[model samples]
Target: MFNEVRRRRAVQRVRPGDGRALKRFRWWQLPFRALFYLRLTRDDGRRTVCAVDVRHWRNNSSGNVKACLYVDGRQHARSGLPAAFPVPGGVVEVRMSAFGLKRCHYVTADGAEYQLVPDGDSAEGRRAHFDRRHPALSRGVGFLSSIVLVVAVFLLVVQLAEQLTRADGVSPYVGAFSSPVDLSAWGNSVVGLITLTASTERALRLRHSWLLDGAAG
Candidate 1:
């Protein structure tokens, strides 16, 4: 029931797009750009390719973050973040987190869903390649990312709880609290960097937890 309502609201967010071909990710655009592709076959046998392009770095300059969908090689639709484009076979959903894209998948009418493949030259593509070529190593990295997120979230919760106990007016009733492994301000910054790295690595595989990732963000 909840999922259905979310989808209905998401579809309403879609906006029309001027037809434009999906651009290849450039070397200089790595930090600012993300592009992903999906291909579906129609009943008559023709093929349609869908691409979701987002320029987060550019968004900083424009003051708007948006994701565009390309059909075949031309832009078909666009919307602000968390877009859902109606495409053949299913809807292509796009969503972002503070770090980067947390979801970009094609969900079919029959309920099957698949994450689109990234371009070969992109960071996501490179990570996918590593997964295929070295399954063990990829699993190890994934496990490590989970571990890092767990530690980050634990510390974050502790810090927040301790801070709450010391709030201006509530301390007299609840009493002040202190975190067990409290780090100096600089030490906390180091943990923030590691958390960012872990979240980015998980984003490569579209792995996200609302509690963990959302809190970290």
Candidate 2:
């Protein structure tokens, strides 16, 4: 129910594009830019390509980002992050996270969902290519990332609980608790780096969980 309301609001935020041509993805823009495409055939049997473009490094101080919708290389419509751009058979939903894009799916009227293809030169594209070319290796890497995030989250929870229990008035009500594992500053930094890499790996695949990625972000 809440999801539908949020979708409706995002739809309302959509604005017509300025009709500028979509530029090719440049290599230097690899870190900041993201582009994804969806191809669909209309009722008239004509096929059209839709693209979603985002520049991660170009957001406001509030971290409010925007997503642009391009049709056959022409700008069509655009909206803020968490946008839903109306298309022929469905809406193209685009969402972002601190690490990168977490969702960019074409949702059909009948409720089916399809993810858009990332631009070939982009980081996400490279990650996806690796998955197709080396499925076993990719799975192993993905599994490793998941495990890293799980351990990170567990440590975070335990530490947070310990902090809460040691707080001024809190320990009186809730008995003091100590974390099973304590890390030095250097160890914490290494854990942080590992978790960041894991989250980025998941983001490349558009895999995000509010509990995992959200807390990490």
Which is the leading candidate under lDDT? 2
Q: lDDT per model, in order? A: 0.85, 0.91
TM-score of each: 0.90, 0.95
Encode model 1's per-residue lDDT on 1-217: one tens digit a residue. Answer: 7866777777897878888667788877766778899988988999878888888755522355788899888889878767788898779888888888888999998888899998777778778999999999999999999999999999988888899999989899988988898889999999999999999988878788998888789
Candidate 1 residue pairs in backbone clash: 20-75
lDDT (10s digit) by residue, model 2, range 1-217? 7877888898998989999999999999988999999999999999999999998866534467988999999999978888999999989999999899999999998889999999999999999999999999999999998899889999999989998999889999989999999998899999999999999999999999898888887
Give the number of the best model, judged by TM-score.
Answer: 2
Candidate 2 contains a number of clashing pairs equal to 0
User: Candidate 2 local accuracy as lDDT?
Assistant: 0.91
What's the number of clashes in each of the models? 1, 0
Q: What is the C-alpha RMSD of each candidate to the true structure, in Å?
A: 2.2, 1.5
How many steric clashes does model 1 contain? 1
